[model samples]
Target: MRTIVQQGTRCTALAGYVRPDTLDSALAARAKGLRVAAGCTDLFAAVRGPALSGGILDITAIPELRAISETPEHWRLGATATWSDIRLAPLPPAFDGLKAAARELGAAQVQNAGTLGGNLVNASPAADGAPCLLTLEAEVELASRRGTRRLALGDFLTGPRQTALAEDELLTAVLVPKSAAAGHGAFLKLGARRFLVISIAMAAARLDLDGGRVRHAALAVGACSATARRLPAAEAALAGARADAGLAAAITADLVVPGLSPIDDLRASADYRAAAAVTLLRRAVAGLCTGREAAA
Candidate 1:
């Protein structure tokens, strides 16, 4: 086993590792199959999992991959932006809620070092960032020798630890549309402990209000399904409706969709995850209400 450490942080020296500073250079270097490593948070699993299967394309030095910009049409986050970056950003409600989730990802050190792109690439069922990004209608940019393409974050992630990203592509950026930027949103996670624990269930929601009634809404639940999913029934129920305990309860019940396919794991029972996901859904909606009222 070989090891590599930079600035007191542990990384791996795999069979082949290439560090490139530009998008084109990174893409070129990745023409041959290679695993992407930004923060190296999840790369440990790749290095030690089972086999020395592939090379490494280290994109940490790519300047274009570290940008966070706000435009009239969207809030663009570089794939490499750390959880701490999102947490501290002065973003609108949609992203503010995600920032809250980022803060819960781990401890301060993890928040400072773990990258958003890494989370998306890892595509964990319990990833704190996925549900919120799904609700935001975020898009991910994938670059390779073939050129660049974009897809919704939900579409990019096919299943647990699986993504549409190819072996030679690097995730460049995450784009949150302006509509998502202005909407009121919140995220909630239920874990064994408040901090440093994988979520048993989590929910993220965004509400667009018109004259004190929700005109549009998006709701997604994580850890209760194969992938995080938007509660379309719940969203429809909340749309054009006044937010209240009654509405919250109805939405919560409707959130138990069939597609999630949650199974009993060591963390919790299937039934428990399903039930808890609904509770977190309600709380997430309530938090949005609070955020809206605070803004008002």
Candidate 2:
């Protein structure tokens, strides 16, 4: 049997990992079955699990994959852009909630190296950035030697730790549209510890109001579902309704029915996650209300 630290297949591939400096080269390598390594956080998981697995195709050195740009319609966040980049960016209102979540990602090293694309592809239900981006109705761009295609972020994630990305495709960029850019939003996360811990439950909301009537609302919850999901039912409840404790409670209850589908896990009980998920929704609504009131 292979032993850990054997410097065999898994470690050998990683140890000999080549840094491709161009997008074409990275994409070409990916076309040939090379796995891209952006922070290597998840890569380490596969390597250290006592199995000599697939090799890596290092994408961090590709300059084109790491540029964040602002456009008239939306902000384009590059796939390899670090979490620290998001935290420091003067994002528009809809993404400010995302920036808030970015601050709590992990320790400084992880934040400096962790990329938003990684979070989506890693597909951990507890990923801190997932709920924020999902709530913003973000789109993901995938590129391959063949060409490029775009998919809704929610659709891109198919299940726990799984995504729709093909082996030959690379997650190249994230696009946040203008509507989401100007919307009022908030994100709340619950965990055993404040930082560097996986979330028990999290909620993110983007709301639009006209004359005390909700014109639009987008809410998504994570850590309790197969993947982060937008709460259409809860959002519908908020629509045309005032932002008050009663409306918030109703939305919270609706979330318990559809927004979350928790199961017992080592970090938290399903019952605890179910209750906490609702509480998180309530808190996010309250926070958004407070922010809107302050701005008014």
Candidate 3:
């Protein structure tokens, strides 16, 4: 709870918190098993008591970890980049779904302070970022004193509240290949209510057209399984189909329902969640194709 500012950089040091302004310093601290923190929107909510269990390594002061930039082959979202950063970045249409997800995360304050890396680390079953990142085929970059490595977004989220992140590693950034950045994308979420509501079902979709026929499609649904999933069968069914208002017709229950294993929860029943997934996917398809993003 105390900050020391030196040469325009910040380093917070307190009873149980330390924020280092450089990657090397952060990694050295990370090696000691300090909890990694960014934004900490979920951390405070998840902690049952007034204070965190142990020491915290706050990475927000690390300059390199808060940037949003593009390289020739990919767009990099630094792990500390806020939801507002992603929503306002000069990204292509393929990021529309992600931007929409940002807007839907919470009210303005949460959008301003919540970090993308924190979302991945929390690994919530209903995380709004997962489905969108899955559609983009994003990869998370992890760094530790040992070295840095990357994992495909889908592979990183093992299950609800579980991930492939290592104890000694810091999630440095998320990489989106320029190859998947060519098409338009959209997102849809069905919540009990609008503001601050956990999704019962959500879907993210991206589509590329070739000569007025569907050349590529990426469809993913979340809050309907242990982890968000790509609807490959449904995507395959849409291949060569016309890209128009009727694009949603290709979606069928069997194609969309085969892989999900939702359980009955306080928010919604398993059957309702499964059925909502199909509707959300279809609407996401129509939203991306028609340029009128819709929500349910």
Candidate 1 steric clashes: 1
Every candidate's lDDT: 0.79, 0.78, 0.87
How many steric overlaps are in each model, in order? 1, 1, 0
Predicted structure 1: lDDT: 0.79
Please give the lDDT score at residue 248 for candidate 3: 96
Query: Runs in model 2 with CA error above 4 Å?
Result: 1-15, 49-54, 244-247
- Residue pairs clashing in model 3 are none
Q: What's each prediction's TM-score?
A: 0.90, 0.90, 0.93
Q: Which candidate wins on TM-score?
A: 3
Off by over 4 Å in 3: 1-9, 48-51, 292-296
Ranking by lDDT: 3, 1, 2
With candidate 2 superimposed using the best TM-score fit, by how many Å does residue 33's alpha carbon deviate from the native? 1.0
Query: Each candidate's root-mean-square deviation in Å?
Result: 5.5, 7.4, 4.8
**How many angstroms is residue 232 displaced in model 2 relative to the true structure, after the best TM-score fit?**
0.4
Supply candidate 2's per-residue lDDT for 169. Answer: 97
Q: Model 1: runs farther than 4 Å from truth? A: 1-15, 294-296
Q: What C-alpha lDDT, on a 0 to 100 scale, does residue 276 get in candidate 3? A: 92
